[model samples]
Target: MDECSATKSTSLETLVIQNISNVKELKSKLSEIIKKGKDYEFDVSSCVKTLIKSNDQEIVFLTVEAISELVKCDEKRRTYSQKEIISPILDILQKEITTENAALIKQCFRALGNLCCDCDSSRKIILECGGVPNIINLMKKYFSAHSQLSMYAFKTLLNFAIGGQEFTNAMVDGGVVEMLQMVVIQELEKEEIDEEAVCALLSLLSLINENDTEILYSDEINAGVLKVLTNTADIDVSELCLDILHAQAEHDSVKTLIAKHGGIQVVCSRIEQLMQKFDHGELDADQSDVEAILKQACDLIVIVLTGDEAMHILYNKGLGEVYISMVKWLEHTNYHLITTGVLAIGNFARQDDYCAQMMDDKIYDKLLDLFDVYVSFGVQMQKEHSVLHPIEPGTITKIQHAILSALRNLTVPVANKRIIAAQGRAAPTLLGALLSVEDHHVAYKLLAAIRMLVDGQESVARLLGRHKSALRCVARWGHAGEYAGAAGEAPRLLAWAVKLLTRGPYWHNIVEVDGCISSLVNMLVASHSLMQNEAILALTLLAIETLKNISPSSEHPEFDYEKSFISQLIKSEIGKHVSILVDTNCAKMPVEVAENLLAFLDITSKKNKLALDYKEAKVTESLKKFAESRQDLSEDLKNCITGVIAAISDNGKD
Candidate 1:
């Protein structure tokens, strides 16, 4: 900065240096300056230029500190481009502007780290300005002597390597991969582990090839990293170590090492101890940070045990921690953290001992509570045009699917139904959630969860009566999905739609009013056996309930709508389809399916006064043909067919 450049901004330089540390307390004053737009950038540049000329360490440090807070948020980051902020920061890192104060050097590095973190352009700018090589050089230089300071530069570089295969290859080319494993190996077993350096290296392996035997998969590296993790005192460091090991868990060698070293026991105990602290009010100093690491610990546990043997170990050692963590996160307000918690539970459920561990447990009640929270979140999603801010969309969805999956697994044991029914809202909440979802993929899993909840629990079915309207959304989805036509989506949908209405007596009115009858009509003749059979059963319920509600001879206007529905049902070709379905047992619809079909036919003939279509069309021969042809048919189905023949004969006699 020349005298002319210096003279033009002396007062601006003074103001920056004076208020740097006090900026947070006088945020409005700083915000007013940022409100200056381009002038703010120019003013900031001029002040830094002048401060650098002074050759004062404290002043430059203050300037770097001020620069940091200026672009602390997205709005500010966007305003200060790489050319203005990063170019200067790069110049400082290259030692063109030198500082003996470690605090100043660290903060200068901190400023660069922040600049690189939030923007895509920062990576290119840093690389273009030779910042990447210098950053790597600085990290390598400070790594052993001043590891805490090195951690800042390493984190910045890690943020750069987050995406773009090109960037990773560039990092590898720059010796970043070699440097990471060595640093991790060297610093891991010391009295106090360099967690930041170790964690940064651990995170980088996720983007690197964990299978490449040259570096990450080497014996020395695995044993060293595994040893540090299994024996580490800090819960957070152990969590990071679990992450690195998880990336390699796919390899048999890694699994053997981790299990032999008691890594599974270590993770379980750490998670249990950390969560107990949370339960006992020990994390009050930093609840959010503790919760965040808790989520990481939970997620790593999910990925670490990649085999049945490992899963068995985790199940035996980690059940109490898994249960406690899931309950804590399910009740947590942070949607992202909750997913990892759910993931931990879901992975545990895959092993019988693990899944069985939760049988008849009280923990599922919180899962039911999560069902309520997600329903509200789903409904809110429909109401808002934008969501998942401050949280990743993938994170939120992964968790939602995890919870549904966990519930499905838990519900596989019959006694778990008591937990769901105990909360009264779990069944209804899931039903209503189905109605509001915009994502068909999540809806698919949620439907499976709902099926499990109400499958054999009559009380759960009865509870669904409370959310009749959203359950009809189930019908709407079935209606739309059936037309998707031979795609996997259609049958998957029809399966749940049938499950929803298998307790049809509880939801018949909303089912009819919401136009589910049209979709159900299509299912009666569907090509899939599952859909066709469930359709027949669902129709039986609808026909029986509709008949019970409205008499065909009634003169009341309200009865006219119901009568019109009967006419529509007949017109929809249900009569013809039912006769055709009963005529064949080659597809092997279950006996209850035939019984329900016969029951539907009997009730329809009794109420509508229409001649039995199958018999009227010469179906007496078709029934005898089918009954004799299929000896493999169940005896109950034989009995149902005999009863159907009797009903038809009685009708003819009249």
Candidate 2:
């Protein structure tokens, strides 16, 4: 009565009951529904419910078969309420699969599989109704008798597993892993194997998180299975086999076996073939083939070769096409392709000319846009605003980590810094990620990129100073993360802060941020050599400003002396900590660090009314060594240390 009320006609349920003995009539009625599916008002699903209970196997099989045709040929699975039909179909499958009704079972599976084909909601309904466990059992039971049943089963599973890693993990949990291993083993044994079966295995393998513990490749010897599969003749077989191997290759032994056993050549060959097909627009049946190869090849080559040996002969093997293909994949809709491709190209960062290659290819400009999109998208998602739909977090993390790493790679070239600075968005976009991204890995990589970008250029450092939020983020994280244990973003971030703190106007904001003083104080005492060195040098700058506050003509300091963080320094125990640092680790410290420490003492001792006693400088053992030793320290350090000691003992000078 809603819209198609005038089209009231014979329900398929009526025909089903009337033609209990007539296969011809039942087939005719069902065929009409299959043809004019929208024209019929028949509760065909109800007829399915009736015939499945009739104990008449032919009627039941015919009824389910008719429903499958209607579902398959139309948009019912996507349009209608799939739950009403899904529950009944699964009920028939669960009960009928155990009986001797092969035709009924096959058509029942076809019905359910067709229903699950087009909609994620329908697939989840099937899963929630315990349909996956049932179908997997049917595949196990009927696999030897008729492989097509298992093929259909796997096709449905493939549909269920399509959208993401979690669903794939669900499939693997529901026994698909063992089912796929068996199918691969069987396909290898047979003279005429089913291509659908191989595709099924590949599709399932695609869902396996490159690091899924639930689908452990080691115990199954899936590497050997995958190695045998790489020589396949079909495009999907080649594409998916390489994808699985690419994921498995994240493990060292698996990567070596795949590479050592000619798998690399097979993968490279498929890439060339697929690229040719894609270029010619000839992938009529192999729709996802080219993108798959790009994804798999990029991931495999990047991880297997560059994963362990980044700056070596592994990349020198004429990977020119591979590199080009990766840059091209940056335009792909799937950011995974873009992400993995970026990571692969990043491996070449250590190579001499690749940075130039990436620039010539306009990779950074593309990455600039990609970085902006990903960072903005990530910010929107984290806020969970009403109008915005969030992308999957795993994918966002992949993209962010890749962008930061690729940007980090670009910064490696001493010359590309100018290119990145020229892009205008590169610095701001990277700075934007620092404020919004939740993942610390991305933050670390972003910090490292910014560090390398501003390493030597005082002009760019001053440019970065205009963004107050960026400065606060850097200073805050640099100070807070200074004590971060293990090798992490702390070293690079602190290094950048060290450079920026004394650079220009950015120095004035330090007093605005409450902990900037003690942050530098703690950074000086940090265990990492780079952090320690940068920290002392940073304090050296601050101490110069402090000296100007005490005595203006004492030195021609460039900083605005009155607004300096000098008072905060007195409260943070600057003199005692510096002496402690010199006493405990002077010899272990770098020569430049030793030099900067001496410079820090030079000014603090020159303070007309010091916070801690100037007498403490005389007792400093490290200073005594630098004063007495013949080790030719930097003239600046020697003079600073000499002045501090001389001031400490003007009475003894006579």
- Which one is best on TM-score? 2
> Which pairs of residues collide in model 2?
none
Off by over 4 Å in 1: 1-261, 264-300, 304-309, 317-337, 349-362, 371-378, 386-388, 482-507, 519-532, 545-557, 560-654
Among these predicted structures, which one has the highest lDDT? 2
Clashes of 1: 0
Give candidate 2's error at residue 305 in angstroms.
3.7
Q: Which stretches of candidate 2 lie over 4 Å from their true place?
A: 1-227, 232-301, 307-319, 385-388, 482-506, 549-563, 583-587, 608-654
- Taking all chains together, each candidate's TM-score versus the true structure is 0.50, 0.54
The global Cα lDDT (0 to 1) of model 2 is 0.64
Query: Candidate 2 at 484: error in angstroms?
Result: 2.8
Q: TM-score of predicted model 1?
A: 0.50
The number of residue pairs in model 2 that clash at the backbone is: 0
